[model samples]
Target: MPEADGAGEQVGVGPWSGGSPPDDPRYDPELLAHGDRRNVVDRYRYWTVEAIRADLDARRPPDRHLHVAIENWAHDLNIGSVVRTANAFNAAGVHIVGRRRWNRRGAMVTDRYLHLHHHPDPAAFAAWAAHADDGARLPVVGVDNVPGSVPLEGRELPARCVLLLGQESSGLTPEAQAACDVVVHITQHGSTRSLNAGAAAAVAMHSWALQHA
Candidate 1:
Protein backbone atom coordinates (compact mmCIF):
# COMPACT_ATOMS: atom_id res chain seq x y z
CA MET A 1 0.00 0.00 0.00
CA PRO A 2 1.25 3.47 -0.85
CA GLU A 3 1.62 5.69 2.17
CA ALA A 4 0.24 9.21 2.08
CA ASP A 5 3.04 11.70 1.53
CA GLY A 6 3.51 15.34 2.40
CA ALA A 7 5.01 18.08 0.25
CA GLY A 8 8.46 17.22 -1.28
CA GLU A 9 7.99 13.46 -0.71
CA GLN A 10 8.03 11.38 -3.93
CA VAL A 11 4.72 9.82 -4.93
CA GLY A 12 3.60 7.42 -7.72
CA VAL A 13 5.87 5.42 -10.02
CA GLY A 14 8.47 6.79 -12.41
CA PRO A 15 8.32 6.43 -16.20
CA TRP A 16 7.93 3.03 -17.79
CA SER A 17 11.29 1.29 -18.12
CA GLY A 18 10.44 -1.20 -20.89
CA GLY A 19 11.50 -0.73 -24.50
CA SER A 20 7.92 -0.19 -25.71
CA PRO A 21 4.87 0.95 -23.81
CA PRO A 22 1.76 -1.21 -23.63
CA ASP A 23 -0.42 -1.21 -26.73
CA ASP A 24 -3.56 -0.70 -24.65
CA PRO A 25 -5.48 2.40 -25.70
CA ARG A 26 -6.43 3.16 -22.13
CA TYR A 27 -2.85 3.99 -21.23
CA ASP A 28 -1.77 7.62 -21.64
CA PRO A 29 1.26 7.85 -23.95
CA GLU A 30 2.48 11.00 -22.27
CA LEU A 31 2.36 9.46 -18.83
CA LEU A 32 4.05 6.33 -20.09
CA ALA A 33 6.78 8.33 -21.86
CA HIS A 34 7.42 10.50 -18.83
CA GLY A 35 6.08 9.33 -15.45
CA ASP A 36 2.75 8.86 -13.60
CA ARG A 37 2.97 11.01 -10.52
CA ARG A 38 -0.74 11.64 -10.10
CA ASN A 39 -2.30 10.49 -6.83
CA VAL A 40 -4.15 7.49 -8.21
CA VAL A 41 -4.45 3.80 -7.47
CA ASP A 42 -1.81 1.46 -8.87
CA ARG A 43 -4.25 0.03 -11.42
CA TYR A 44 -4.74 3.51 -12.92
CA ARG A 45 -1.12 4.65 -12.76
CA TYR A 46 -0.70 5.41 -16.48
CA TRP A 47 -4.34 5.52 -17.50
CA THR A 48 -5.82 8.62 -19.11
CA VAL A 49 -8.43 10.61 -17.18
CA GLU A 50 -11.20 9.56 -19.55
CA ALA A 51 -10.12 5.93 -19.40
CA ILE A 52 -10.10 5.88 -15.64
CA ARG A 53 -13.54 7.46 -15.47
CA ALA A 54 -14.93 5.04 -18.05
CA ASP A 55 -13.49 2.07 -16.18
CA LEU A 56 -14.94 3.24 -12.93
CA ASP A 57 -18.34 3.78 -14.50
CA ALA A 58 -18.28 0.34 -16.08
CA ARG A 59 -17.36 -1.40 -12.83
CA ARG A 60 -19.91 0.41 -10.68
CA PRO A 61 -22.50 -1.89 -9.21
CA PRO A 62 -26.14 -1.01 -9.69
CA ASP A 63 -26.72 -1.40 -5.99
CA ARG A 64 -24.21 1.36 -5.24
CA HIS A 65 -26.91 3.99 -5.67
CA LEU A 66 -25.97 6.67 -3.20
CA HIS A 67 -25.72 10.32 -4.30
CA VAL A 68 -24.39 13.38 -2.44
CA ALA A 69 -25.62 16.97 -2.38
CA ILE A 70 -23.75 19.88 -0.82
CA GLU A 71 -25.07 23.36 -0.14
CA ASN A 72 -22.49 25.68 -1.63
CA TRP A 73 -24.21 28.99 -0.84
CA ALA A 74 -21.08 30.18 0.95
CA HIS A 75 -18.44 28.58 -1.27
CA ASP A 76 -17.56 26.47 1.73
CA LEU A 77 -14.13 24.87 1.77
CA ASN A 78 -15.65 21.72 3.24
CA ILE A 79 -17.43 21.16 -0.07
CA GLY A 80 -14.22 19.95 -1.69
CA SER A 81 -13.49 17.49 1.10
CA VAL A 82 -17.03 16.19 0.82
CA VAL A 83 -16.56 15.72 -2.92
CA ARG A 84 -13.36 13.72 -2.37
CA THR A 85 -15.17 11.46 0.09
CA ALA A 86 -18.08 11.06 -2.33
CA ASN A 87 -15.65 9.93 -5.01
CA ALA A 88 -14.06 7.45 -2.60
CA PHE A 89 -17.49 5.94 -1.94
CA ASN A 90 -18.32 5.85 -5.66
CA ALA A 91 -21.43 7.97 -5.32
CA ALA A 92 -23.85 7.95 -8.24
CA GLY A 93 -23.45 11.73 -8.57
CA VAL A 94 -22.73 14.91 -6.62
CA HIS A 95 -25.05 17.94 -6.58
CA ILE A 96 -23.96 21.43 -5.74
CA VAL A 97 -26.84 23.67 -4.68
CA GLY A 98 -26.60 27.46 -4.69
CA ARG A 99 -23.14 28.43 -6.00
CA ARG A 100 -21.72 26.66 -9.03
CA ARG A 101 -18.11 27.63 -8.40
CA TRP A 102 -16.79 26.14 -5.15
CA ASN A 103 -13.42 25.82 -3.47
CA ARG A 104 -11.97 22.63 -5.01
CA ARG A 105 -8.57 22.66 -3.32
CA GLY A 106 -9.60 20.06 -0.74
CA ALA A 107 -10.86 17.75 -3.50
CA MET A 108 -7.28 17.13 -4.73
CA VAL A 109 -8.55 16.69 -8.32
CA THR A 110 -10.85 13.77 -7.45
CA ASP A 111 -13.90 15.61 -8.83
CA ARG A 112 -12.76 14.79 -12.36
CA TYR A 113 -13.76 11.17 -11.80
CA LEU A 114 -17.30 11.84 -10.58
CA HIS A 115 -20.45 13.23 -12.16
CA LEU A 116 -21.37 16.68 -10.85
CA HIS A 117 -24.51 18.79 -11.07
CA HIS A 118 -25.38 22.36 -10.15
CA HIS A 119 -28.67 23.95 -9.07
CA PRO A 120 -29.57 27.59 -8.58
CA ASP A 121 -31.05 26.90 -5.17
CA PRO A 122 -32.46 24.23 -2.92
CA ALA A 123 -35.86 24.36 -4.60
CA ALA A 124 -34.36 23.68 -8.00
CA PHE A 125 -32.42 20.76 -6.62
CA ALA A 126 -35.50 19.38 -4.93
CA ALA A 127 -37.48 19.68 -8.14
CA TRP A 128 -34.88 17.74 -10.06
CA ALA A 129 -34.77 15.06 -7.37
CA ALA A 130 -38.52 14.70 -7.63
CA HIS A 131 -38.27 13.91 -11.32
CA ALA A 132 -34.78 12.66 -12.05
CA ASP A 133 -33.82 11.51 -15.52
CA ASP A 134 -33.72 7.87 -14.35
CA GLY A 135 -37.42 8.12 -13.39
CA ALA A 136 -36.66 7.26 -9.80
CA ARG A 137 -37.66 9.95 -7.35
CA LEU A 138 -34.77 9.60 -4.93
CA PRO A 139 -35.36 10.63 -1.36
CA VAL A 140 -33.35 13.61 -0.12
CA VAL A 141 -31.84 12.67 3.23
CA GLY A 142 -30.40 15.62 5.11
CA VAL A 143 -27.54 15.23 7.60
CA ASP A 144 -27.71 17.70 10.43
CA ASN A 145 -28.41 17.89 14.16
CA VAL A 146 -31.25 20.34 14.07
CA PRO A 147 -34.54 19.97 15.89
CA GLY A 148 -36.73 16.96 15.13
CA SER A 149 -33.81 15.01 13.63
CA VAL A 150 -33.35 11.29 14.12
CA PRO A 151 -30.09 9.47 14.79
CA LEU A 152 -28.43 8.04 11.71
CA GLU A 153 -27.06 4.95 13.43
CA GLY A 154 -28.92 1.78 12.45
CA ARG A 155 -31.05 3.82 10.09
CA GLU A 156 -31.75 2.20 6.75
CA LEU A 157 -30.89 4.74 4.09
CA PRO A 158 -32.61 4.39 0.76
CA ALA A 159 -30.66 2.46 -1.83
CA ARG A 160 -31.17 5.28 -4.34
CA CYS A 161 -31.16 8.33 -2.16
CA VAL A 162 -29.28 11.62 -2.02
CA LEU A 163 -27.40 12.52 1.15
CA LEU A 164 -27.65 16.28 1.51
CA LEU A 165 -25.30 18.43 3.58
CA GLY A 166 -25.24 22.13 4.33
CA GLN A 167 -22.56 24.76 4.72
CA GLU A 168 -19.89 24.33 7.42
CA SER A 169 -20.64 27.36 9.56
CA SER A 170 -24.42 27.45 9.14
CA GLY A 171 -25.69 23.95 8.62
CA LEU A 172 -28.80 23.05 6.64
CA THR A 173 -30.47 26.30 5.68
CA PRO A 174 -34.24 26.31 6.22
CA GLU A 175 -34.86 25.91 2.53
CA ALA A 176 -32.50 22.94 2.30
CA GLN A 177 -34.04 21.23 5.29
CA ALA A 178 -37.51 21.78 3.93
CA ALA A 179 -36.44 20.07 0.73
CA CYS A 180 -35.39 16.88 2.50
CA ASP A 181 -37.69 13.89 2.78
CA VAL A 182 -36.18 13.03 6.12
CA VAL A 183 -33.46 14.62 8.26
CA VAL A 184 -30.97 12.47 10.17
CA HIS A 185 -28.17 13.32 12.57
CA ILE A 186 -25.05 11.57 13.84
CA THR A 187 -24.95 10.67 17.51
CA GLN A 188 -22.02 12.12 19.39
CA HIS A 189 -20.59 11.44 22.83
CA GLY A 190 -18.10 14.31 22.77
CA SER A 191 -18.89 17.78 23.98
CA THR A 192 -18.44 19.43 20.61
CA ARG A 193 -21.55 21.21 19.32
CA SER A 194 -21.46 19.40 16.01
CA LEU A 195 -19.12 17.50 13.69
CA ASN A 196 -17.23 19.28 10.96
CA ALA A 197 -19.06 19.23 7.67
CA GLY A 198 -16.47 17.03 5.96
CA ALA A 199 -16.29 14.52 8.84
CA ALA A 200 -20.06 14.42 9.08
CA ALA A 201 -20.34 13.72 5.37
CA ALA A 202 -17.87 10.82 5.61
CA VAL A 203 -19.77 9.31 8.52
CA ALA A 204 -23.10 9.61 6.77
CA MET A 205 -21.73 8.14 3.54
CA HIS A 206 -20.09 5.27 5.41
CA SER A 207 -23.32 4.57 7.23
CA TRP A 208 -25.23 4.43 3.95
CA ALA A 209 -22.57 2.18 2.42
CA LEU A 210 -22.78 -0.14 5.41
CA GLN A 211 -26.50 -0.51 4.88
CA HIS A 212 -26.67 -0.74 1.10
CA ALA A 213 -23.25 -1.05 -0.56
Candidate 2:
Protein backbone atom coordinates (compact mmCIF):
# COMPACT_ATOMS: atom_id res chain seq x y z
CA MET A 1 0.00 0.00 0.00
CA PRO A 2 1.04 3.57 -0.61
CA GLU A 3 1.90 5.86 2.27
CA ALA A 4 0.24 9.23 2.54
CA ASP A 5 1.92 12.44 3.65
CA GLY A 6 0.66 14.69 6.40
CA ALA A 7 -1.66 16.26 3.84
CA GLY A 8 -3.32 12.86 3.24
CA GLU A 9 -2.05 12.65 -0.34
CA GLN A 10 -0.72 9.24 -1.37
CA VAL A 11 2.88 9.38 -2.50
CA GLY A 12 4.07 6.01 -3.81
CA VAL A 13 3.57 2.33 -3.07
CA GLY A 14 5.72 0.55 -0.49
CA PRO A 15 7.77 -2.55 -1.33
CA TRP A 16 6.03 -5.76 -2.36
CA SER A 17 4.34 -7.10 0.77
CA GLY A 18 2.77 -10.32 -0.47
CA GLY A 19 3.94 -13.76 0.62
CA SER A 20 5.71 -14.51 -2.65
CA PRO A 21 6.88 -12.23 -5.47
CA PRO A 22 4.79 -12.30 -8.62
CA ASP A 23 6.06 -14.24 -11.65
CA ASP A 24 5.87 -11.29 -14.06
CA PRO A 25 9.08 -10.42 -15.87
CA ARG A 26 8.07 -6.82 -16.37
CA TYR A 27 8.27 -6.06 -12.66
CA ASP A 28 11.77 -5.19 -11.40
CA PRO A 29 13.00 -7.24 -8.45
CA GLU A 30 15.05 -4.28 -7.13
CA LEU A 31 12.06 -1.98 -7.36
CA LEU A 32 9.86 -4.61 -5.79
CA ALA A 33 12.22 -4.91 -2.88
CA HIS A 34 12.42 -1.14 -2.51
CA GLY A 35 9.65 1.42 -2.91
CA ASP A 36 9.01 2.91 -6.37
CA ARG A 37 8.84 6.68 -6.01
CA ARG A 38 9.54 7.50 -9.62
CA ASN A 39 7.16 9.85 -11.34
CA VAL A 40 5.43 7.30 -13.50
CA VAL A 41 1.80 6.32 -13.94
CA ASP A 42 0.25 3.71 -11.66
CA ARG A 43 0.51 0.99 -14.29
CA TYR A 44 4.33 1.21 -14.32
CA ARG A 45 5.07 1.59 -10.63
CA TYR A 46 7.38 -1.42 -10.34
CA TRP A 47 8.36 -1.94 -13.97
CA THR A 48 11.93 -1.67 -15.25
CA VAL A 49 12.88 1.05 -17.72
CA GLU A 50 13.03 -1.42 -20.60
CA ALA A 51 9.65 -2.91 -19.71
CA ILE A 52 7.98 0.49 -19.62
CA ARG A 53 9.44 1.44 -22.99
CA ALA A 54 8.35 -1.86 -24.53
CA ASP A 55 4.82 -1.41 -23.23
CA LEU A 56 4.64 2.09 -24.66
CA ASP A 57 5.91 0.83 -28.01
CA ALA A 58 3.28 -1.92 -28.03
CA ARG A 59 0.53 0.60 -27.33
CA ARG A 60 1.60 3.03 -30.06
CA PRO A 61 -0.63 3.04 -33.13
CA PRO A 62 1.33 2.01 -36.19
CA ASP A 63 -0.31 4.39 -38.66
CA ARG A 64 -1.17 7.42 -36.56
CA HIS A 65 1.67 7.94 -34.10
CA LEU A 66 3.13 11.45 -34.38
CA HIS A 67 6.79 12.54 -34.27
CA VAL A 68 8.28 15.77 -32.96
CA ALA A 69 11.56 17.45 -33.95
CA ILE A 70 13.32 20.39 -32.36
CA GLU A 71 16.36 22.44 -33.33
CA ASN A 72 18.89 22.39 -30.46
CA TRP A 73 21.51 24.79 -31.81
CA ALA A 74 21.31 27.13 -28.83
CA HIS A 75 20.90 24.51 -26.11
CA ASP A 76 17.37 25.78 -25.49
CA LEU A 77 15.98 25.01 -22.06
CA ASN A 78 12.54 24.53 -23.53
CA ILE A 79 13.63 21.36 -25.32
CA GLY A 80 13.29 19.33 -22.13
CA SER A 81 9.74 20.47 -21.61
CA VAL A 82 8.92 19.67 -25.22
CA VAL A 83 10.35 16.17 -24.76
CA ARG A 84 8.27 15.69 -21.64
CA THR A 85 5.13 16.77 -23.49
CA ALA A 86 6.01 14.42 -26.35
CA ASN A 87 6.27 11.57 -23.86
CA ALA A 88 2.82 12.42 -22.50
CA PHE A 89 1.42 12.27 -26.04
CA ASN A 90 3.30 9.03 -26.77
CA ALA A 91 5.14 10.51 -29.76
CA ALA A 92 6.66 7.93 -32.04
CA GLY A 93 10.10 9.53 -31.79
CA VAL A 94 11.91 12.78 -31.06
CA HIS A 95 14.56 14.23 -33.36
CA ILE A 96 17.20 16.59 -32.04
CA VAL A 97 18.69 18.69 -34.81
CA GLY A 98 21.87 20.75 -34.70
CA ARG A 99 23.34 19.74 -31.28
CA ARG A 100 23.28 16.26 -29.82
CA ARG A 101 23.50 17.31 -26.16
CA TRP A 102 20.57 19.06 -24.47
CA ASN A 103 19.53 20.03 -20.94
CA ARG A 104 17.45 17.18 -19.55
CA ARG A 105 16.38 18.62 -16.21
CA GLY A 106 13.06 19.99 -17.41
CA ALA A 107 12.09 16.64 -18.91
CA MET A 108 11.76 15.12 -15.42
CA VAL A 109 13.58 12.01 -16.77
CA THR A 110 10.78 11.10 -19.19
CA ASP A 111 13.30 10.99 -22.03
CA ARG A 112 14.45 7.63 -20.67
CA TYR A 113 11.20 6.13 -21.99
CA LEU A 114 11.24 7.84 -25.40
CA HIS A 115 13.06 7.04 -28.63
CA LEU A 116 15.45 9.92 -29.26
CA HIS A 117 17.38 10.60 -32.47
CA HIS A 118 20.18 13.00 -33.27
CA HIS A 119 20.79 14.82 -36.54
CA PRO A 120 23.80 17.05 -37.16
CA ASP A 121 21.77 19.68 -39.00
CA PRO A 122 18.43 20.45 -40.57
CA ALA A 123 19.45 18.97 -43.93
CA ALA A 124 20.44 15.67 -42.37
CA PHE A 125 17.22 15.58 -40.40
CA ALA A 126 15.22 16.27 -43.56
CA ALA A 127 17.06 13.53 -45.43
CA TRP A 128 16.38 11.00 -42.68
CA ALA A 129 12.69 11.87 -42.68
CA ALA A 130 12.51 11.37 -46.42
CA HIS A 131 13.89 7.83 -46.22
CA ALA A 132 12.57 6.69 -42.86
CA ASP A 133 12.38 2.91 -42.44
CA ASP A 134 8.58 3.11 -42.20
CA GLY A 135 8.63 4.07 -45.93
CA ALA A 136 5.99 6.76 -45.53
CA ARG A 137 7.36 10.12 -46.59
CA LEU A 138 6.48 12.23 -43.56
CA PRO A 139 5.73 15.86 -44.22
CA VAL A 140 7.71 18.29 -42.12
CA VAL A 141 5.29 20.81 -40.64
CA GLY A 142 7.08 23.80 -39.16
CA VAL A 143 5.39 25.45 -36.18
CA ASP A 144 6.21 29.13 -36.06
CA ASN A 145 4.37 32.42 -36.30
CA VAL A 146 6.11 33.48 -39.47
CA PRO A 147 4.89 35.20 -42.58
CA GLY A 148 2.99 33.00 -45.08
CA SER A 149 2.23 30.41 -42.36
CA VAL A 150 -1.31 29.10 -42.18
CA PRO A 151 -3.27 29.16 -38.91
CA LEU A 152 -2.93 25.89 -36.99
CA GLU A 153 -6.25 25.99 -35.13
CA GLY A 154 -8.38 24.24 -37.77
CA ARG A 155 -5.62 22.77 -39.88
CA GLU A 156 -5.74 19.04 -40.53
CA LEU A 157 -2.28 17.81 -39.61
CA PRO A 158 -1.06 14.72 -41.41
CA ALA A 159 -2.01 11.43 -39.75
CA ARG A 160 1.69 10.58 -39.67
CA CYS A 161 4.06 13.54 -39.65
CA VAL A 162 6.83 15.34 -37.84
CA LEU A 163 6.04 18.63 -36.11
CA LEU A 164 9.27 20.60 -36.41
CA LEU A 165 10.15 23.47 -34.11
CA GLY A 166 12.96 26.02 -34.07
CA GLN A 167 15.13 27.75 -31.48
CA GLU A 168 13.88 30.17 -28.84
CA SER A 169 15.68 33.42 -29.78
CA SER A 170 15.18 33.07 -33.53
CA GLY A 171 12.43 31.20 -35.30
CA LEU A 172 13.21 28.67 -37.95
CA THR A 173 16.47 28.99 -39.81
CA PRO A 174 16.49 29.37 -43.57
CA GLU A 175 17.46 25.74 -44.12
CA ALA A 176 14.77 24.45 -41.76
CA GLN A 177 12.09 26.60 -43.36
CA ALA A 178 13.15 25.43 -46.79
CA ALA A 179 12.85 21.80 -45.74
CA CYS A 180 9.35 22.18 -44.39
CA ASP A 181 6.52 21.05 -46.66
CA VAL A 182 4.24 23.57 -44.96
CA VAL A 183 4.32 25.99 -42.05
CA VAL A 184 1.57 26.72 -39.53
CA HIS A 185 1.21 29.18 -36.69
CA ILE A 186 -0.88 29.10 -33.54
CA THR A 187 -3.12 32.15 -33.68
CA GLN A 188 -2.47 34.49 -30.81
CA HIS A 189 -4.80 37.20 -29.43
CA GLY A 190 -2.66 38.37 -26.52
CA SER A 191 -0.01 41.03 -26.14
CA THR A 192 2.91 38.63 -26.50
CA ARG A 193 4.46 38.30 -29.91
CA SER A 194 4.92 34.53 -29.58
CA LEU A 195 4.55 31.74 -27.06
CA ASN A 196 7.29 29.98 -25.16
CA ALA A 197 8.70 27.08 -27.15
CA GLY A 198 7.36 24.48 -24.71
CA ALA A 199 3.83 25.94 -24.67
CA ALA A 200 3.82 26.19 -28.44
CA ALA A 201 4.83 22.53 -28.76
CA ALA A 202 2.06 21.43 -26.39
CA VAL A 203 -0.56 23.33 -28.37
CA ALA A 204 0.71 22.05 -31.70
CA MET A 205 0.86 18.43 -30.46
CA HIS A 206 -2.63 18.71 -28.98
CA SER A 207 -3.86 20.08 -32.28
CA TRP A 208 -2.42 17.08 -34.12
CA ALA A 209 -3.86 14.66 -31.56
CA LEU A 210 -7.29 16.20 -31.99
CA GLN A 211 -7.24 15.54 -35.70
CA HIS A 212 -5.58 12.11 -35.88
CA ALA A 213 -4.89 10.52 -32.50
Candidate 3:
Protein backbone atom coordinates (compact mmCIF):
# COMPACT_ATOMS: atom_id res chain seq x y z
CA MET A 1 0.00 0.00 0.00
CA PRO A 2 1.21 3.52 -0.73
CA GLU A 3 1.79 6.01 2.03
CA ALA A 4 -0.71 8.78 2.59
CA ASP A 5 0.16 12.39 1.77
CA GLY A 6 -0.34 15.48 3.90
CA ALA A 7 -3.91 15.75 2.62
CA GLY A 8 -4.60 12.07 3.56
CA GLU A 9 -4.67 10.92 -0.05
CA GLN A 10 -2.60 7.94 -1.11
CA VAL A 11 0.44 8.81 -3.17
CA GLY A 12 0.84 7.07 -6.54
CA VAL A 13 -2.47 5.35 -5.98
CA GLY A 14 -4.95 3.69 -8.33
CA PRO A 15 -8.56 2.55 -8.02
CA TRP A 16 -9.41 -0.21 -5.52
CA SER A 17 -11.48 -3.32 -6.22
CA GLY A 18 -14.66 -4.37 -4.43
CA GLY A 19 -15.14 -7.26 -2.01
CA SER A 20 -15.11 -10.34 -4.24
CA PRO A 21 -12.73 -11.26 -7.04
CA PRO A 22 -14.09 -10.95 -10.55
CA ASP A 23 -15.11 -14.18 -12.28
CA ASP A 24 -13.33 -13.15 -15.44
CA PRO A 25 -9.94 -14.71 -16.17
CA ARG A 26 -8.47 -11.35 -17.00
CA TYR A 27 -8.59 -10.22 -13.37
CA ASP A 28 -5.60 -11.07 -11.24
CA PRO A 29 -6.42 -13.13 -8.18
CA GLU A 30 -3.92 -11.35 -5.95
CA LEU A 31 -4.96 -7.89 -7.05
CA LEU A 32 -8.62 -8.68 -6.29
CA ALA A 33 -7.70 -9.77 -2.77
CA HIS A 34 -5.44 -6.79 -2.03
CA GLY A 35 -6.74 -3.82 -4.01
CA ASP A 36 -5.26 -2.84 -7.35
CA ARG A 37 -2.83 0.07 -7.28
CA ARG A 38 -1.27 -0.19 -10.67
CA ASN A 39 -1.36 2.83 -12.98
CA VAL A 40 -3.94 1.61 -15.47
CA VAL A 41 -7.36 2.51 -16.80
CA ASP A 42 -10.54 1.82 -14.78
CA ARG A 43 -11.48 -1.06 -17.09
CA TYR A 44 -8.10 -2.65 -16.32
CA ARG A 45 -8.34 -2.44 -12.55
CA TYR A 46 -7.63 -5.84 -10.93
CA TRP A 47 -6.64 -7.22 -14.32
CA THR A 48 -3.32 -8.93 -14.89
CA VAL A 49 -0.71 -6.85 -16.69
CA GLU A 50 -0.43 -9.37 -19.51
CA ALA A 51 -4.19 -9.49 -19.85
CA ILE A 52 -4.35 -5.71 -20.28
CA ARG A 53 -1.60 -5.83 -22.88
CA ALA A 54 -3.41 -8.59 -24.76
CA ASP A 55 -6.61 -6.57 -24.76
CA LEU A 56 -4.86 -3.47 -26.08
CA ASP A 57 -3.14 -5.50 -28.79
CA ALA A 58 -6.39 -7.11 -29.89
CA ARG A 59 -8.27 -3.85 -30.25
CA ARG A 60 -5.50 -1.67 -31.67
CA PRO A 61 -6.99 0.47 -34.41
CA PRO A 62 -6.03 -0.27 -37.99
CA ASP A 63 -3.82 2.36 -39.67
CA ARG A 64 -2.56 3.41 -36.26
CA HIS A 65 0.98 2.47 -37.13
CA LEU A 66 3.27 5.37 -36.30
CA HIS A 67 6.74 4.44 -35.07
CA VAL A 68 9.04 6.47 -32.80
CA ALA A 69 12.81 6.22 -32.76
CA ILE A 70 15.32 7.83 -30.42
CA GLU A 71 19.07 8.05 -30.47
CA ASN A 72 20.43 6.85 -27.12
CA TRP A 73 24.14 7.46 -27.36
CA ALA A 74 24.22 9.36 -24.08
CA HIS A 75 21.92 6.96 -22.21
CA ASP A 76 19.55 9.92 -22.31
CA LEU A 77 17.26 10.21 -19.32
CA ASN A 78 14.69 11.65 -21.70
CA ILE A 79 14.26 8.26 -23.38
CA GLY A 80 12.06 6.95 -20.60
CA SER A 81 9.75 9.96 -20.75
CA VAL A 82 9.57 9.59 -24.51
CA VAL A 83 8.64 5.92 -24.07
CA ARG A 84 5.87 6.89 -21.69
CA THR A 85 4.56 9.44 -24.16
CA ALA A 86 4.68 6.85 -26.94
CA ASN A 87 2.53 4.51 -24.84
CA ALA A 88 0.05 7.33 -24.23
CA PHE A 89 -0.27 7.79 -28.02
CA ASN A 90 -0.41 4.04 -28.76
CA ALA A 91 2.54 4.08 -31.10
CA ALA A 92 3.22 0.96 -33.18
CA GLY A 93 6.62 0.56 -31.49
CA VAL A 94 9.71 2.42 -30.25
CA HIS A 95 13.15 2.01 -31.72
CA ILE A 96 16.28 2.72 -29.71
CA VAL A 97 19.38 3.38 -31.74
CA GLY A 98 22.95 3.46 -30.41
CA ARG A 99 22.69 1.90 -26.93
CA ARG A 100 20.40 -0.83 -25.63
CA ARG A 101 20.34 0.36 -22.02
CA TRP A 102 18.65 3.65 -21.05
CA ASN A 103 17.44 5.38 -17.93
CA ARG A 104 13.89 4.20 -17.15
CA ARG A 105 13.10 6.38 -14.13
CA GLY A 106 11.12 8.92 -16.16
CA ALA A 107 8.99 6.28 -17.88
CA MET A 108 6.81 5.76 -14.75
CA VAL A 109 6.68 2.06 -15.69
CA THR A 110 4.95 2.80 -19.00
CA ASP A 111 7.70 0.98 -20.94
CA ARG A 112 6.14 -2.35 -19.99
CA TYR A 113 3.11 -1.57 -22.13
CA LEU A 114 5.08 -0.49 -25.21
CA HIS A 115 6.84 -2.58 -27.88
CA LEU A 116 10.55 -1.64 -27.96
CA HIS A 117 13.15 -2.50 -30.58
CA HIS A 118 16.88 -1.90 -30.30
CA HIS A 119 19.54 -1.38 -32.92
CA PRO A 120 23.28 -0.99 -32.36
CA ASP A 121 23.51 1.91 -34.78
CA PRO A 122 21.45 4.41 -36.70
CA ALA A 123 22.12 2.74 -40.05
CA ALA A 124 20.71 -0.54 -38.82
CA PHE A 125 17.57 1.15 -37.53
CA ALA A 126 17.15 3.05 -40.78
CA ALA A 127 17.46 -0.19 -42.77
CA TRP A 128 14.83 -1.94 -40.70
CA ALA A 129 12.45 0.99 -41.11
CA ALA A 130 13.01 0.98 -44.85
CA HIS A 131 12.39 -2.76 -45.24
CA ALA A 132 9.97 -3.53 -42.45
CA ASP A 133 8.15 -6.85 -42.67
CA ASP A 134 4.82 -5.12 -43.31
CA GLY A 135 6.59 -3.27 -46.15
CA ALA A 136 5.08 -0.01 -45.09
CA ARG A 137 8.52 1.44 -45.87
CA LEU A 138 7.80 4.28 -43.53
CA PRO A 139 9.42 7.60 -44.23
CA VAL A 140 12.07 8.49 -41.66
CA VAL A 141 11.26 11.96 -40.40
CA GLY A 142 13.77 13.62 -38.14
CA VAL A 143 12.61 16.05 -35.44
CA ASP A 144 15.12 18.74 -34.62
CA ASN A 145 15.50 22.50 -34.71
CA VAL A 146 18.57 22.49 -36.89
CA PRO A 147 18.90 25.18 -39.53
CA GLY A 148 17.27 24.54 -42.92
CA SER A 149 14.73 22.21 -41.24
CA VAL A 150 11.11 22.69 -42.32
CA PRO A 151 8.45 23.67 -39.80
CA LEU A 152 6.25 20.77 -38.68
CA GLU A 153 3.13 22.92 -38.63
CA GLY A 154 0.84 22.49 -41.64
CA ARG A 155 3.17 19.87 -43.08
CA GLU A 156 1.33 16.69 -43.98
CA LEU A 157 3.18 13.87 -42.22
CA PRO A 158 3.06 10.43 -43.76
CA ALA A 159 0.36 8.07 -42.53
CA ARG A 160 2.99 5.46 -41.82
CA CYS A 161 6.12 7.20 -40.72
CA VAL A 162 8.85 7.01 -38.10
CA LEU A 163 9.70 10.11 -36.08
CA LEU A 164 13.38 9.91 -35.16
CA LEU A 165 14.73 12.17 -32.48
CA GLY A 166 18.22 12.83 -31.22
CA GLN A 167 19.80 13.13 -27.80
CA GLU A 168 18.92 16.05 -25.56
CA SER A 169 22.25 17.87 -25.57
CA SER A 170 23.77 16.99 -28.93
CA GLY A 171 20.69 16.91 -31.10
CA LEU A 172 21.01 14.56 -34.10
CA THR A 173 24.32 13.09 -35.14
CA PRO A 174 25.45 13.47 -38.70
CA GLU A 175 24.72 9.83 -39.47
CA ALA A 176 21.26 10.05 -37.98
CA GLN A 177 20.53 13.23 -39.91
CA ALA A 178 21.71 11.54 -43.09
CA ALA A 179 19.22 8.73 -42.57
CA CYS A 180 16.26 11.09 -42.43
CA ASP A 181 14.05 11.37 -45.52
CA VAL A 182 12.70 14.70 -44.28
CA VAL A 183 13.63 16.74 -41.26
CA VAL A 184 11.02 18.87 -39.52
CA HIS A 185 11.24 21.37 -36.66
CA ILE A 186 8.68 22.38 -34.09
CA THR A 187 8.00 26.09 -34.11
CA GLN A 188 8.57 27.88 -30.83
CA HIS A 189 7.98 31.54 -29.94
CA GLY A 190 9.38 31.34 -26.43
CA SER A 191 12.86 32.33 -25.31
CA THR A 192 14.01 28.76 -24.82
CA ARG A 193 16.23 27.49 -27.59
CA SER A 194 14.30 24.21 -27.77
CA LEU A 195 12.03 21.93 -25.80
CA ASN A 196 13.24 18.81 -24.05
CA ALA A 197 13.61 15.84 -26.37
CA GLY A 198 10.87 13.93 -24.56
CA ALA A 199 8.51 16.89 -24.71
CA ALA A 200 9.34 17.37 -28.37
CA ALA A 201 8.53 13.72 -29.01
CA ALA A 202 5.13 14.07 -27.37
CA VAL A 203 4.32 17.12 -29.49
CA ALA A 204 5.46 15.33 -32.64
CA MET A 205 3.43 12.23 -31.80
CA HIS A 206 0.36 14.35 -31.11
CA SER A 207 0.88 16.10 -34.41
CA TRP A 208 0.91 12.77 -36.22
CA ALA A 209 -2.14 11.61 -34.29
CA LEU A 210 -4.04 14.72 -35.27
CA GLN A 211 -3.40 14.03 -38.94
CA HIS A 212 -3.21 10.24 -39.13
CA ALA A 213 -4.84 8.63 -36.13
Q: Name the top TM-score candidate.
A: 1
TM-score for all predictions? 0.94, 0.93, 0.89
In order, the Cα lDDT scores of the candidates are: 0.89, 0.89, 0.83
What's the CA error at residue 13 for candidate 1, in Å? Answer: 0.9
In candidate 3, which residue pairs get closer than 3 Å at backbone N, Cα or C atoms, i.e. clash?
none
Q: Deviation in angstroms for 6 in model 2?
A: 18
- Model 1 lDDT on a 0 to 1 scale: 0.89
Instruction: Give the least accurate 10-residue stretch of model 1, judged by summed lDDT.
Output: 1-10
Residues 74-115 of candidate 2 have per-residue lDDT tens digits of 979999999999999999899999989999878877899999
Q: Model 2, residue 124: displacement in angstroms?
A: 0.2
Model 2: residues with Cα > 4 Å off, grouped in runs:
1-11
| lDDT tens readout by residue for model 1, 56-139 | 888767755888999987868899899999989988789999988999878878898899999999999999999873776889
> How many clashes (backbone N, Cα, C below 3 Å) per candidate?
0, 0, 0
> Model 2 Cα displacement at 204 (Å)?
0.6
RMSD (Cα, Å) for all candidates, in order, is 2.6, 3.3, 2.9
Question: What digit string (tens of lDDT, one per residue) describes model 3 on residues 43-116?
Answer: 77777778877876766665656889999999689998899898888787889999899998777676787788
